[model samples]
Target: MVTRALIESVLTRARERSRLLTDSVDDGDLVAQHSPLMSPLVWDLAHIGNQEELWLVRDVGGREPVRVDIDALYDAFEHPRSTRPQLPLMDPAQARAYVRTVREKVWDVLDGHPLAGSPLAENGFAFGMIAQHEQQHDETMLATHQLRSGDAVLVAPETPDLGGTPEIDTEVVVPGGEFVMGTSVEPWALDNERPAHAVDVPSFGIDTFPVTNERYLAFMDDGGYERRELWSERGWSHRREAELAAPQFWEWDGKSWWRRRFGTMEPVRLREPVVHVSYFEAEAFARWAGKRLPTESEWEKAARWDPRSGRSRRYPWGDEDPDDTRANLGQRHLGPAVAGAYPAGASGLGVHQLIGDVWEWTSSDFLPYPGFSAFPYREYSDVFFGGDYKVLRGGSFGTDAVACRGTFRNWDHPIRRQIFSGFRCARDVQGEQA
Candidate 1:
């Protein structure tokens, strides 16, 4: 059970992260649209506040609306990211003040409302939901910073070096069978990850670490982009249309490749997990390496299933929440840690970096599990369930612990590369039933 103190702590931590991310940039940067794929930082700032007010202050506490006039402006379904800039958004100062006011009101609700007796409030689920929502937006804002073209506006310490990279095996075998695939008990879990269900998976060999830049470079060096046979029909078509020769923000000088990260250009760190690649790119690379992207079930089994116990873990490292030692998460580092950097966080099958680094793309489409039901709303998960989007497991460096878990699901179009994404290869075990 969650305590009021824990809820307060998480809410405070989420707000602190939101403030740091937004304050890192100037007011001008906050209002500017860094990319059409993402909203202006100011819009996200106000939207975070608006959501808290709607869910907690009013809905949970039976309080009056806070700035009801601006509700439509911040309603995400009402406006797409491309058109958010055209709306009458609160400026940086006003956005700050607005969120502050909303937070004060939310605290009042938290103090008065019982933590049980309702689905939304049981175990402080609504408060946890709000915290997770804000953290998710904080990650979105970090992506916007990555898309912005300007001098470096954010600073973070480098991930701790594990002395030197460990000499770990390249891959591990998951002797998969039936494993629980989703959660019914995680209080803050969203609608899509509900009703934990059993999945029978065939044994498979999966990469021990996320595919590194060095490995991806080998694929590119072998004319991976020029070869169409390695790619699917639609993937090839999109590749040709976009002319995606490398991961996003990558440039080749006369001699070597360098990538721009949040305004600073640096040589590609070959040891780090390759980021900003689309599903098509990950797929083509997997084929080039004589393997395939793991199915969603395969990925989860590798990350969460422990054969000795015949059960699933809440995280690769166990039920405990993430910290700096476990994963390179919460934007503590500007980029992924070197591959094989987190041996302590390895799963039961010795899969390293499965919880955090870059979001690993899977071969499965985004679909609801059996016994799926939309709770509270439909737009959160219902509208996006289909083949139009591919499922991505795990979380990126920008993802926060509140918003990521063993069963947490993320998805995007096959052609999207701007988000922090990567992949690992898998192959069916020889002579084994899959």
Candidate 2:
């Protein structure tokens, strides 16, 4: 199904998104580091171009290198985010010109190359990979905009409201059994999501909707942060060490809580799923609610498995791609739609907001699936396979559809709160108190 036209369109769309995010701010802002957690926006711009050139122009097309001298400068592994601003990164004008030149060459490679034979080119996998890569950075850049300190620089239409909260059930039972966990047929699936396999997940009760701001506020009012008993040993330690109080960007006014969204201050919408909570924070909140974070498998089952059909879907709503009606994705809205807003996007078992809103943290660590193998490069996924990273399923509002899906996996350090992340709670079906 991956045709030359489709590949071109995907790549074009990715570039447009990348440009929109970068062009929103001035060159000075682009070159400055908004957070130690992320690289300067200019670094990301050139890095995106460098990766495209490395993978497509050189590796796939066997074309001559473009600006081989600057490769080291943009090599992400060579420079950490904290040190990136100190490095001699490309100026905005130079970075823009460099990427433009590289893209022109890439277009020639794409038009001349056949989309077959090798695994990288077969079904246009490499092109799709590059598109996904750019989109991932686009999401990262959007997060940088959120972290930036200044006036609001970016804007998007508000997410659709379901008028009022829908009268939906609060929880749903995934009568789980064996389900296919990963993908073998998805043309663009990355190494971590490859080699489809079966996983037997026990039945569990998962929240019908993600934990909303209203619900999380209840936890805060009840002293969720102060109660050490609700947190794991390490989580409790991190909570105290970081002096964690509220979710990142949240501030308590004299009357109510307000949050900074992309440099704009607004009252925290009680109906929206709370974003920017760390994995530790999500864990603590789940414990306080008398529930537990679902394991990676449980989250996937709740989002993808249809018990009646004994089949797994490509997304929560089915095999179709995401749209405005399905989920709050592609930065279509600056924030999550009100919880229970996307009724049509609910999973087979009636779990709502499972696909997008915020990246939902799971109890599982980032680990390889059964019969996993590194493809093309080990640095992509193999390097981070361990307990230090917790698996986060589903994509956030800032996530692009090209880089997200039912099996798509995201991971981060347990204490990372800068990334847009939230959680839904689950409990075992058998005699587990909730």
RMSD of each: 1.4, 1.6
Candidate 1 residue 215 C-alpha distance from true site, Å: 0.2
Q: Which 10 successive residues of model 2 have the least lDDT summed?
A: 161-170
Those runs of model 1 whose alpha carbons end farther than 4 Å from true positions after fitting are 167-169, 432-434
lDDT of 2 by residue, 208-285 (tens): 988989999999999999999999999999999999999999999989999999989999998889899999999999
Off by over 4 Å in 2: 167-169, 431-434
> lDDT scores for all predictions?
0.90, 0.90
lDDT of 1 at 338: 91
In candidate 2, position 150 carries an lDDT of: 89
